[model samples]
Target chain A: MNFSYPEFLVKVSENCIKCRRCIKECSFGVFSWDGEKIKINHEKCVACHRCAACCPASAITILKYPVSFKENHLWTEEILRDIKKQADTGGKILTGCGNDKPYPVLWDKMLIDACQVTNPSIDPLREPMELRTYLGKKPEKLEFWHDKSGEIKLTTVMEPQIKLETPVIFAGMSYGAVSLNVHLILARAAKELGTIMNTGEGGLPQELLPYKDHIVVQIASGRFGVNLEYLNSCAAIEIKIGQGAKPGIGGHLPGEKVTEEISRTRMIPAGTDAISPAPHHDIYSIEDLRQLIYAIKEATRYRKPVGVKIAAVHNVAAIASGVVRAGADIITIDGFRGGTGASPKVIRDHAGLPIEIALARVDEQLRKEGIRHLASIVASGGIRSSADVLKAIALGADAVAIGTAALIALGCHLCQKCYTGLCAWGITTQKPELTRRLNVEEGALRVTNLVKAWNLEIKEILGALGINSIESLRGNRERLRGIDLDEVYLDVLGIKPAGR
Target chain B: MKIDARGMHYRELNERIHDAVLKGIKEIDIVNVLGQRYIGTGIGEKVTINVYGTPGSDLGAFMDGPVINVFGSCQDVIGNTMNNGKIVVHKDAGNVVGLSMRGGKIFIKGSVGYRTGIHIKAYKDQCPVIVIGGKAGDFLGEYMAGGILVVLGIFGREKDPIVGRFIATGMHGGTIYIRGSINKSHVAHDVSIEEIDENDLSALKNIIQEFCDAFGITDPNSILSHQFLKLRPKSHRPYGQMYAY
Candidate 1:
């Protein structure tokens, strides 16, 4: 009576050996051994490529299922499949990862400007390129006074700032959402790169305490595992207002997934559900948000920077302005295509604005209000490459946080089934047998390599533009030009159209 | 150490408290404390803070270990996300008291506003307890996952119910004890009401004894004379079946 169809067609070639290694490697139980040869259940194959990579004989060939229904554009195959699933289960369709819709990726529609004849591009190999950036509030003006001992001294107080070797940070990924091995890898990579990794609303585990200096602990509506010790141990704090993947909604980590380790970290019962409310009940107004911000500052003794993260919704500029005026040292804007552990398909695919437009509008609004220096902006969601990072900076972001990219670096094949808690590559699962597949040291090295490579690519881009410092490119919209984009987008991005 | 907080800004008052706590000063008496927010905040030491006047919102927020005794009424969010400590307010308080508090004990001598003791959770040995001496407003324990909440309704107005409407909405864990009968319309569907059992009576007795000790009440048995009703979540996972996956 099942009406669902297999998304992938997995075929084992004639080169198959009776090794049976694929059985242990496949976390989704897609392959089985019949005592003579290996049997494949193509229906269960998520196409994570874990078994394919581990197959010694190189026999597995996975392809998209090429059967179709009546060729009606209105009722597409994907829509029909979804309808069948709903009809069978009588449940709403749930999904993981970012939006898979055919929305325009604004980063691809923008081109970077480079120097040519008059201002020749400098070679990155020979010239010094400064990629070191700081994320925090900057003073409006510098004031200095001589001390009584005849020494020049600064009179204005300086706010706390987080230093980044490369303007890239690992976005918030909770330990419960991903594996502990993934958190370990992210922590190690952040340390090696001199950057930060955010502990998304889930509490920090004791094992990750060594990298506390390079970690940003998040405080969301749930207030999970948030205590004085948790606050004082981290380098910075982030008040998570909303994430782009599921804007205007909350998160629910089911009771079945709350293992002992996760329970200890989140400070909840071992088998109880951890529910995060959609909005912070205490924060009903901007003034209430300010109260919580100052409360955190007060608890930390004003020693650490506090950032407020919000999804890129309409009127994001005004919201960002209020957040800055509410005494946040940093602002993080998550675009519509942000990744998530689990979100309703309806909310994930159809909610929030793109980071490009939101970043530009927020930056311009903050600058127009003469309060741009009050807080730094960190753009997140759908930053794929070093080019995207550079382009995000030019679009008015102080830095960019990478979530999905970092997960990919740690061996996520993007099967979009992370909510099932059965990640084959050991990146997102809590099962002991699956989590063991991801080695901490090896995963850390891979992520570190990715970050280092991206750093070089960014330096090369900077040199091509005749800019030596990354800070020089921040909010420098003149260096960007739109291609095949409408006037409204171009106007909001504050960039000129090509051939203008 | 006795600090006079007259005409002092909240930042200055807090800084003074921090400086004193760092200097190993215990038992601070902050007098004339008119609307000073976040008093005793960030103080992890085993000191005592006694405030005389009306304090502002978020008193003892994120305070790990300390004892704060307020002589007058306080604003909203007192003991917000507090880890471990004791806060004894002699007068009435505002909304959202003891919000998201993981561990500690808050005893309000008089009534409180709406949403008091919301989202108070307990893990292992750390259970937060909030005891309201008088009636509470609407949504008394909404989204409460764990911990203990008791409303005595000792000083409530005549014919005004002990708590307002929509009590314990979205609550999945924890126990709520009210001194008198509850209005059926005021309770949420997710909670179940029952008569107190032997174990519940013992637990409530110990909590009421502590509440009596804090307010210097003469007869704890007299307060326990009224029949108490117990409220607990019918199911630990109220929304467990609501999700599709």
Candidate 2:
């Protein structure tokens, strides 16, 4: 296949020094020196803007194409035209954000019919609408009795103790992959929002140690910076078995970005390439995953909930069932369109199943197995709006994690420039100036605003549905309806066609 | 001090080691510890640990400043990412040995598995070195940006001088020296190979002699009798002018 670079803005500047820094820095070989001046091959560029950032005299500038053509159309006419063209070509639908297709967003399609005639829609101004969610296993059998001292002794002491005021969470973004400022922003946002943000497999930064209660630490294959203390310093622990973008493959952080600080944080040698091995050396089977889960549980003394995170794949329902059987408190599934710091392009575009199908299947399978309530499900990978959240919960997820969406709230344009390590928005880079662009205070406020908006929207939906609490919406498949879907999709989603 | 961990698992051995260290034990003697994985994984601080038997994969992975001296054979990923520490292994180790190691000295008294010293780098005063007493497995020093890897094939008795393919693949910097003839076809297209002259030989001899001294090899004379081949990346300007408009 012939390869063509994505279109980018080219501004010709006379201040070219021909230093060849762009040539040296680009991993994709996007720039070349033509003896007298540096030349950029636009076709090869992924629009990462590393060259523009590295240019000493600021001779290079990359301008992204405007995504919005008109205000009311939702998507630009060009994007709509492109979507139709893809459909005409019999090609798979490809999009960046959480399910950007014209499919009737179930959250938007199903109007909550408020009972203005019979039941009163409780005023949120005076009455409380509880958004608080406890994500862990609930006891199957409860035995309450009095001890010899006449004190009530509970049969089980809730296996894990992670509490969230809001059902929303910020997903994993490691320190080395993202800047410390970004992590701090996410942590502070979680703390302020009464939620949690995961420390994506790269280990927790020392600066974010104080917000330990708001953090969800991860243990991956590399185990680069994991320790007993690191494990204990989190509200929850996630075992990153696979990522949505590149499910089967591992990760590689180039030596150039592995600076002294990143090195120290990751507990690896500075300036050496950090390679996360393809498979967990210790985990070969579901039984082995259980051993690791129990080991971590034993290590943490059951203080924090243990979550198994996997990419949403074809066999996700079966896999999630296995995870539930392994005694995991929660299971997080990331769909195909998930974000990544660095992953092979082939893997990013090809691997994993969609989040919608995976969520529905896993929920159905768990409910059928009579263990649906044994573990809570958290769906991630391209969750963009409150509508998606409602649809996710309706599909059987207790909550959802938002990584790319959170970054967008903090000024990311979804430029897919994270792998380049020169993200202009400061969400994905460690460079001081670029990182400074993302003010942690302002970023936290943006995140808080986003989640706050979503929470209000959830309340509005609930109020319309004549429900006061989010628990009523959980696994309420009766509220969802499928549109323009085939027999297989209908059967898989267990949804009837619209108007039926 | 003598602990036989022949059939003991990684968790059990790690627990025992943790307990011993907590009890203020300065030195540990581990015996018959066959296939026990992650022997000293993520242990921060200095301690003298001696292993009398074979250890499993990632024997000293993510180890910080601890002297791990193994008196027997070890498996894959020995001394992986070990920063500021010393690992002296008396027997051969398995695949991808010393992968991405940054700051440390790994002196193997025997041969190593494939991709030995791959992606090994250096920063400032911290330069990692891996000295192999025997021949290395394939893809030795692959993608190595910094540091040095010295493979002293004590004698060329092993079949297929370097076992594996694509030696020094993607290597942009760093040096790899082997004391035996490497088939020209096996050398990666990206790497430049040259015979080590007297000056290079002397530097290699010093490192090999250190390995000999640590492992009780009385003579470095026979080790020096073989010719040395050095591999370096052909281009600091790799990827060529692919980006030129």
Please name the candidate that would achieve the greatest lDDT relative to the true structure.
1
Clashes of 2: 3
lDDT of 1 by residue, B5-70 (tens): 999999999999999999998889999999999998877888999999999999999898999999
Candidate 2: pairs in clash: A5-A43, A32-B243, A112-A464
The C-alpha stretches of model 1 lying farther than 4 A from their native spots are A146-152
The interface RMSD for candidate 2 is 8.7
| Alpha-carbon RMSD to native, per candidate | 1.4, 8.5
- Quote each prediction's TM-score: 0.98, 0.73
* lDDT per residue (tens digit) for residues A130-166 in model 2: 7888898878878888999999999766777568887
Docking level of model 2: incorrect
User: Model 2's lDDT to the true fold?
Assistant: 0.76
Question: B81, model 1: CA deviation in Å?
Answer: 0.6
Give the per-residue Cα lDDT of candidate 1 at A126.
Answer: 98
